[model samples]
Target: MMYIRTNQLLKAVILLLFAVFLFLLHETGEIARFINPQYVHLSQIASILFLFLFFIQVPRMFTNSEDDLCGCGLWGCSHGEEGRFAMKHVISYGLISLPLMIGFLFPFKDFGAAEALKRGVQYQVSQREARDEASLEKNVQELLEQSALVLHRDNFVSSLRALMAYPTRFVGKPILLEGFIIEDCQDEKVTVITRFLVTHCVADSHAAGFILEHEDSLGGREEQWLQVMGVLDVKQHGGVLLPVIRVIEWEEIEPPANPYVYP
Candidate 1:
């Protein structure tokens, strides 16, 4: 690839793309070693080389006269003497290329330190949340192992009451919840999301509810509720219980006339 003969136009394009790709990949953690700034010394040097090549091609590319182009692939196709060269093209090139050249020549260390700090803080918070959520899950597991009973109709009702009081706290719990299909499962299962309610409004609301894997699509029609009496296993992340239901049994029943939870 190094010896692959290429025109200046293609070379400039490839270099520009190289810079953009490097930046984007760095953002996504896809180019970790390259963006490390410490270990990626050779990569940084390669970037500088590409940038230099791109700039050296630019002023040549903007030149109207083929004579001004020392080489065959100096620039894109151009209009001859009949047209005057536009200042916009050259001015725009200067505006873009100057900062890039300067930044490459003198990269900021303080700015990098701040960026690293921000990323470190974000990572710490993420790890902390994961730990807390793990601890809570262990507690729930211990509770279940001892004599803690699975959720039933009465507890589900109580959970609902609790859900309404502290919507954020319990709304996302994996309660062994059973409700009538009331309506067709818009997406999956014979289950309607009895808990996917939003507080501010439906727009801001998330349909955060346990999915009851009822196979029959039309088994429970409107107004036909179901009996969901099982254990409500709580798997929390960032203090939010991700719904993971352990279904005991489900039976058909009449749906409550007023079904939507008033958030």
Candidate 2:
């Protein structure tokens, strides 16, 4: 019937549009804003696969009636829903298409300090084996030799992990690092320099960083990226000893191309 053919064509157009949407996200490299860098290759593969499926579905749009066989020319062909028009089906299709529409209309944003607050920041490190401790110390030493204990974006997660694990080992040692501001206390003199640590992807991202103690107020610095140079110091906070960064110098910096640090 003409009605069946029209519905089939509409479905095919929707499928084609969804495929194009995903393909564009991958092409623009904006997919990283939503997903982990490690899984970018998988997203790329999915985009290609979607486009391939769209091409296969294109033939259905021209057919005046359902084909007795699928694209593979085999028996037991299936055209999902087969011209059925029900509220449930319509709602389901709308839900499926909603994300595509939103992505097209809204600009992609990297997760920021507001998201970090909901997730909370973690800084404590647990005990490690003697051999592991030695290896970690050696690695830290190599980084320490690079003046002011500079931490690069590439190794930010691992280096911070090492520092957290062995706070005493790194105490009095100066460090240079970068992260966005996280409001932590009523007193505007102190704030947390926080990084989003993504173990697998953005879905699992968690805030990680050290408490920064500065004489200057942090009233207007919330969510702003800052490069901090300081010495690691142990301070008593809330009746517990915690590692704090005694900030010697800090400056506002532009956000990095890839804002999330992978563990």
Query: Clash pairs of candidate 1?
Result: 178-228, 180-225, 180-226, 196-207, 196-208, 198-205, 223-255, 225-254, 225-255
lDDT of 2 at 29: 75
The runs of at least 3 residues in candidate 2 whose Cα sits more than 4 Å from the true structure, single-residue gaps closed, are 1-4, 65-84, 126-138, 144-146, 185-190, 238-240
- Tens-digit lDDT track of model 1 for 52-109: 7778776444444445444233444333421343576457555656655654566332
lDDT of 2 by residue, 1-263 (tens): 42234444556667777778878877887776667678878877877777777677665544333453222222123454455567886887788778877888887788898898788777665455324777677766765566557777788877886676667767788888899998865333358899987767788888888898878755578899999998998866565466789888998999988788775
Clashes of each: 9, 0
TM per candidate:
0.26, 0.82
